[model samples]
Structure formats: structure tokens, C-alpha cells
Target chain A: MNHDAYPDSYIRGILNSVKTIAMVGISPNTSRPSYFVFKYLLGRGYRMIPVNPGQAGKDILGQAFYAKLSDIPEPIDMVDIFRASEHVMPIVQEALTLKPKPQVIWMQLTIRDDAAALLAEQAGIKVVMNRCPKIEYGRLSTEISWIGVNSRTLSSKRAQILGKGVQRMGLGTPKD
Target chain B: MADAERVPGFATLAIHAGAKPDPTTGARITPIYQTASFVFDDVDHAASLFGLQAFGNIYTRIGNPTCAVLEERVAALEGGTAGLAVASGHAAQVVVMHALMTPGDEFVASKKLYGGSINQFNHSYKNFGWNVVWADPDDIASFEKAMTPKTKAIFIESIANPGGVITDIEAVSKIARKAGVPLIVDNTLATPYLCKPFDYGANIVVHSLTKFLGGHGNSIGGMIVDGGNFNWTRKGQYPMLSEPRPEYSGIVLAETFGNFAFAIACRVLGLRDLGPALSPFNAFLIINGIETLPLRMQRHSDNALAVSEWLSKRPEVLWVSYPGLAGDKYNALAKKYVPKGCGAVFTFGLKGGHEAGVKLVSNVKLFSHLANIGDTRSLIIHPASTTHKQLSDAQKVQAGAGPDVVRLSIGLEDKDDIIADLEEGLTAA
Candidate 1:
């Protein structure tokens, strides 16, 4: 993978297919960016599992936190890495050991390691780097653009309003 | 990878950037969401909405679906990260300053500006303890001299009102960068069709949509666009973005919202408390006006240039101040910045002085003698007797609104008709 840019279709496909995500390096503090992302995704109907060693055995937004990815009891469709570049290799290595490997490994904004991405790609797992899933979801769905943020995507198609008059758009997945 | 993604052009964005078919009725036009509040899904959903953890409409005062489309369209046109719509151009200025300025803080602004803005900055803003420091757009060094530790922002107009002076946006932007402040450009006259201030290093772009963006003069509106290039977190200069807030559980806006933090600040903090919101009906009208912005602006510019050229050769006109004409002082900067055209508004001095200006306005047949601009009908105003009446003689001259100056906002009328009407007005004067 070039890792320089991921096409919108490639990102949208992963987002629509993944129902549950495990966010590593999430902080207990609400002021942190990671916590904001976690809360946002949870509100968007994603099953968010926080994996933070410091906050292990506690709950964040009503979701249990585990010390590591292996401790997640259920299958994870994606593993969202929020740590620094130096710590990504060990996490990717650990992800390769899961019985049914996660479909995608997404690194948060400013966190990228080509070596780890290559390792994940070799194991048939999709890898994205230096991007935030929260921002991507907002961009793809036309949510952030409501308040004047540039989503860089334009469509004439009317956004489908879900329950309660809330508008949500899907990646090009047929089931979505 | 798949074929390279195709981005929409300017005209396409102006027509469809923030709009979609109505989801419930499937109406082709965006419906006016005429309600005060929205019903929540439940207690938890309501909590999430109030906490800023979710993005949805809660109240009309903060956000409305109809206004949101207009906001998105303008932001797209300006190539900005985000935009916020407010009541009027002056209201937009107030909201922006509310976010950036504290008591006793100051901002540097160009001396060449709309007479009403000068009045607002000089008298009204002082009540808030926000001092206005004047700088000359003609003298770029005056901007550097006006800077102080108290300066939070630098304000200028891309193409000044009445004078049609083309400001050195890039030069002033460099000074602003060196001073560690954001540069705010009032792009009311230039509009996004003529110039994108962000392209010239402006950190923020503001507009009185009552003008060109709305194209027609039927509606009143304003907008603030975030360029998303300035670092609000640098050295903790902007506490509104850097510091934690107690209102929504202490989340820092810059950290959470990233590039569009300034827009969020203006909304969640400023607009929420100050209470100057753009109505949905006006937003709908503005959105319709913007659909034909490119065509209207081109005609306005073409007609304006033709009229300026005609007036320059007339014996009754002493001087014409339009940057689009050859041999004008600001023509080079105009060509560099707004190559498309110098916009529709410009001023000309009468040989008979202030009384002649008053006579010309009173006698004009095709041109409507009014205080507004950017209308489909040609509008005329004598600044000395009307708009600039509040300013002193020296101040009026400094703002390019001298006693003899008569301003014309050329419209989409035919070039010959506009000139014929101007000839009659000058002959009567």
C-alpha cells in the first residue's frame, strides 16, 4: 500500500463493513482527542471497546476496558491504534495472533509506521495510516460539512435520514 | 488505485455544495426548518447532543438545517475549512471579535473601509473595551507599526468599499504571521467569485452576504470562514481554543475539532450567548441567489469596467477611482489579486464638488438612489451626504469618500444603458 493516500472507496468500504472497533491507547480523561473519537463513534452506533492499560478493569462510556487487544472477548472488526509510531509494531504483531484476524488496522492521526503496515498487509489484513476514523466517518457521511467543514466529497444524492430525523450516509457497501 | 477522483467545479459547488433533496417529502429544494427546537430520541441521546459528543440540531439559535446548507455552500466556494452564518456583516464581526478579543484587547484595521464599519469600530466597539488601531492599506508598513502585544487580529478589505482599492493581502498577511495573529479579510465587495482571501494567506474570510454572494439585495446575512491554517494552540495565544471549557466537560475545542476549531468556537461560545442568528427564510433566499453567482458577478464586473471607462473620459468627472482601469494606482495589485475583474462598486469625483454629487444621485433615472450595493439594478449613493456623513472631512478623504466622491454600484444592465443613464446624471449635475 502507498500509505500516502487511501482512496475514498477504500476507506468507505472498511468503515461500512466494520461494526465493532477496539481503540487502543484511549485515555480516561474526556478532554483527550481519543476519548472524543471513542464517544463519537459510539454515538454513531459502533461498538467501541477501549483497550488502555492504565484504565484497565474500568468502564468508559459504559464499555469495559481491557489491558490488551487479546483480552477482548468478542471479535473486533477493526483495531484503531492511537499510540505513537514507536509502539505500533508490537500491537500489529499481537493483532496477527488472533484466531479470526481483524479486517482492518487503522492508525490515528499522526501515528504511522510503514513497517507495521507492511506486516499487517502480509497477513491479509487491510492497513491505514496517519488517519483518524472519526474524521473520516464524518467526512464520508457529510456530517462535518453541516457546520461548514470541508468534507472534500460532493454528491447530488440526497442523504438518507435515519431514525429521529438524523442524516447518515454509507460507504458504497451494498448492505449499508 | 481507481481512476483519479474528479472534484466538482466552482459552479457545481455553488449550486449543490450544501443542498440535497428533502429526505421526508423528497422536495427538490431544501425546506425551511421553521421550528425552535428538535425532539430528542431519548434521555441518553439528548445528553449526547448537549455534550457535543454528537452532531445534530438541538436549537434554531445555534444551528438550523436550512442555514447549514448555506454555510456549507459558502465554505465550499471560499475553499475554507468551515463557515458560520450570522444575522448581518456587522454581527459576524461582533461574533468573531467575541471569540478572539477579551476586555482591553485591540485589533488593527485598514483606514480605507466602509463608513459604517469605521463608525462601528470607533464608537460601538469601545464600549466592549476592544480598541481599534487604524492602519493604511496604501502604506503596508503602517500595519507593522500598528501592531502591539494587545493585537489579536488584523482586519482588511480585499477590495475596499467606495474606493475600489486593491489591498496587498499577501504583504499584510506576512506581517500578521510575524506578529503571531490571524488576518481577517472582509471580502464583501470581491466575493469568492473575484478573490479567495485564503489563497493570499488570510486566516479568516468574512462577508456581508447581503451583497454579491446573495447577488440580489432582498436578504441580509453574513459569514465567517475559517482558513484552518492558523495554529490556535501556538504559545497559548488564544485561550478560547487552547484552554479547557467547563460548559461541556472541559474539552479543548482546538484539540477536539482540529482544523475547524475556530468555526466551532464562534458557534458554541459566541453565537450561543450573543444571540444573533440568521433566519432560515433569508438563508433560503441567499442560497437561491448564489446559484447564479458566477454569471451575475461576470456581468456586474463587465458593466462596471465599461462605465468606469466612460466616466474617465467625461469632462464632468474630475477623477475616477477604479482599479480595473489602466493607469490607476492600484491596477497592478488588482490584476494580480482579482484578475477576473475589479468588481462592480467604484467611486468617481464630480467637477462641481459635493453639491454636484448630490444632484447626480437625485437625477439618475436607471440607477436607484439607495445605500446598498450588489443588486441587479444599478445603485447610486453620494457618500459625503449619506453614508459618510458621520465622518469628519479628513476622515472622509482618508476613506476615499471625499466631499466630491459619488459611488456607483453598476448592475447587470446593458453596458450602453448604464452609460446613458450616467451621462444624463452628469449632465443634470
Candidate 2:
């Protein structure tokens, strides 16, 4: 799929389906973008398995981190790559070797590897490139539009659900 | 520049980060959204906005588009996650402290700060049940000793006002990190052009936009930038972020907003309740002023250094206490923190004492005898006789306002003209 041509539904579908994520290249430093994305997804109810060789055996946001995706005992629904484009191919190969491979491969902001993405797609995994899950979550939830960030799915239609105590995030159960 | 991976340079970010041509009118400049409230799409839109599920302008008192631009620009320039603009410098202080401390909590503050800030911390904050524990910035060990179980934050000025003393921010930030509290740096005197506190490990940066930021001194405004470097979620130390807030229907801000939660909290709770909103008109003025900060700061620093050197040579001048001067105690700190320049405000002592200080303030023709600093025009003030007049002699000295002291906020005039102006003051004294 052309990454830009992928419909909002396609993007939203992946977000709703993903339950557990293994974030590679996650940093302990709060100022780093990886730290924010990790904490944000965790707060949004996704179980995060942080994989960083340097910070292995440490805890981030109360979750014990592993040196690599292979060390995570539980099945990962998605693999979020925070490393550079050059590093994504090896990370994707590593993800493909996992016991229960991730259903989706999501690259972080500024990371795009067509070859790695093609490999993931050929292996029956979905691919998202050069996008931030934290920003996407906020965009879909209409949290960022107020501050003038374009969410790209402009429509006159308001959300059908109303008057209930709003969920902090606009995520929901995956529709199979 | 279109690539997201390439970080924009400082001048580019300062000019373009939070601003875009008007999507509605195609105005090149960020136009002031001067209305009181925005029209919601429907009841559900309003509800989601109020419910915190959506973010948008609800009322002017809480947020405005023009002020949001100013907030975002400064945040980008400071390398922070987010920023909130408020009415005045003191208002920014109250909001930031309110977000961090509850009643009975204490914060450690550098004693070498602006005279007005000293008054605000020593007197006004006491009424809010937020205690200020003073620590001498000259002695880095004093900050560590001032910390107690009640300490919620560490506060200092990047380059302290009136005296131009550059703080050892990295050293103080380490202490704050060890204590598990945010380090708040006042970057009013040392604007982002001179120093970026976040680069040295500050968790939050507060600025008096009334000064250097609003360079022409046309607007009275302030900002609070969330450095996104503090773990407000750890151990429930910051109940305001980690715990469910009673006002927002038990919603936890940190859980919802991630790194920018402190900035959001200050806007949602602190400014919303305190009601110290920066007017949209002032926001426009300040934003315009910020577009020229890089140019003005360089000139201001150059002029101040030359003026300080001239003052140092005067036989009637007892001492010049400018960090830019090599022989000064804070010179080394200035080189480390404010390498671009040591800012334009500094104090000097007259050999003839209080009478001469008064004489200098009275005689300067080019310098405006005003309380404000960071104006385009030069300003001279005898703090002991004016700004710090209420304090006792000993208190004045402690606040860097001795009877012989005369503060000069060197302006962006030709160096010879500024020297000539000061020359008249010295001759009269």
C-alpha cells in the first residue's frame, strides 16, 4: 500500500487491533521522543515491552525492559521501531524471527525503509512508516486539532457517540 | 526544511515553528484571535472540549490562538514540549509553583534573583502556604542543604537580574534530579538567545516576556516552558499530575498528556482558576518582538560589555559587578552558560555612596530612569532608593541593592552614545 494513500480506517484499524507493543531503541531519558511515545502508549492501555541493549534489565514506566525482542516472553501485537532507517532492516528481520511475530511493523517519526517495509508486507505483516503513534493517537482522538495540528481526516461528520464520560484517548476494541 | 528528521536552526524555529499563514484569510503574520469564545461545531464538540477528550480554544481566559502561537514559538525555541503564556512574570511564577506545590510544600530558590522576585517569594508565596527556602547560588552546596522532605522544586535565574551573575545550572540541576524534583530556571534576563536552560538539564523554564523577550518592552507578558524532562508520574510525589484531579472529573493529567502535562496542568488548573491571561493584543506585540530577539540581544550584550568596561575604569566607580567582565567572580560561569553574551543588566557601586547613586540616576539624559529593563533605550535605576526601597539596609545588600549601587540596563544604542550618556551621569555624581 502507498503509505500516504492508506485510508484513515486502515490506520485506525491497526491502532485498535494492537494490544501489546515492543518498542525498540527506547530511551530512559525523559527528553527523548522514544520515552514520551513509550509512556503515552502505556497510559493509553497498551502493554509495552521496551527493548534496548544499554538499558536492559531496567524498568521504564513500571515495565521491565529486555535487551531485544527475542527476550520478551509474551506475544507482541506490534513492533514499534524508534531507530534510524538504516537500523530498521535488522530490527524487522529480528521481529520476523520472534516466537509469535508482530502483526504490524510501525516506524517512528522520520524513519522510513521501503525495503524493510516491503519485507514486512511480504511476511504477512502490516507496515506504517515515518509516523508517530503518539501524534496519531492524539490526532484521531481530536486532541491535537484544537492546537491547530492537521489530523488529515477532515469531515463535517461529528463522532456518533456523545454525552458519555469521554475516554482520555479515542481508542476502542478492535473489530475483526 | 520540509524533512521532519532535520532539526531546524534556532533562528528558523524562532520565526516559523508555531506560525503559519492564516488558513482563513491568508494573512502572513499570526493575526490576533481577539474574540472571547470560539463557536463550537455542536454540543458534542463543546462537551468533548470541556471533557478534555478534545483540545481547542474554549474561552479567551484559558486559551487564545495568538497567545498559543507565542506559547508554541517560545517552547520550540527553548526546546520544550509545550508552553503557556500568562499576564506577567509574577503570574507565571505563581502558576508554575501552583502546579508543583500544594499547601505546606516548600521550594528551594536562589537568593541571587531579581529584587521583585525576592519580594514575591519571601512575602507573596508565603500567603499561598508555599514556603520558599532561600539558598545562596554563589555556594552550590547551599542549594543541597536547603532541600528537605517538603521541597517540591528548585528555582534559579539563568543569569541573575540586576547583578548579571550566571548560575551553574548543570550543578543545580543534578541536585534537583537527585532530590526527584523539577529544576525551574527563570530565563528572563538571559533570554533563549543567550542561554537555553533546557540544554543544561532544566525541567521547566520561565521567562518574563516583558523584558528581553518582548525586546522593545512594549508588552508585559511571561511564559512557562515544559522541558519534558521530569518524571512527574514517579511515586505520586506530584499528586497534581499522577493522581486524579478533582476539578477535571478525576482525570489524571500526566496519564493523558504525557510529557507536556505540566504545561497543560498550569493552563487547565492554575491559569483557569487564577485568571491571569495575557491579552491577545499583547501576545501579538510580544510575538512581533520575538522575531527580532537574535539581533537585539547581540547588540544589547555588546553595548552592556562596553559600558561595564567604561564604568570599571571610572575613578568615582567603586566596583562594576558584570559577569561579562573577565575579572568578575561570575565571568567563568558566564562563559560556560551564556557564551553568546552575559545579557545587558548589571550593577555598579559609586565611590561617593548613596548620594552619588541618586545623582547618577538624576543626571543621565539618554538613559530612562525607570524600573523596567531590556528596553530599546537605556535605563538607570537606584534600586535602594526605588525598587528595593522597602527593604532594610542589610536586606537591600542581601538582595544586591546596596546604597551605593546603581543598576544600568544598557540599551541597543551606539557604544559611544551610551558611554557619553553614562559619562554625564558620572560627571554629575
- Give the candidate number with the greatest DockQ: 1
Among these predictions, the greatest TM-score belongs to: 1
Error of 1 at B31 (Å): 1.2
lDDT of each: 0.88, 0.84
Clashing pairs in 2: none
Q: Where does the lowest 10-residue lDDT sum fall in candidate 1 chain B?
A: B1-10
lDDT of 1 by residue, B271-332 (tens): 88999999989999999999999999989999999999999999999999999999999999
TM-scores for every predicted model: 0.95, 0.78
lDDT of 1 by residue, A37-146 (tens): 99988877799999999888899999999999999989999999999999999999999998789999999877899999999999999999988888888777767665
Model 2, range B1-429, lDDT digits (tens) per residue? 212235667777667756655444667788888899887767855765676655668898888878887888888788888889999999999999989898899999999888778889989998999999999998999999999999999999998888878789999999999999999999999899889999999999999999988989788998999997888877568888888788877677776676678998998898999999999999999999888888899999999999999999999999999999988999998889988888899999998988999998898899999999999999999999998898899988987899999998989989899999889878972
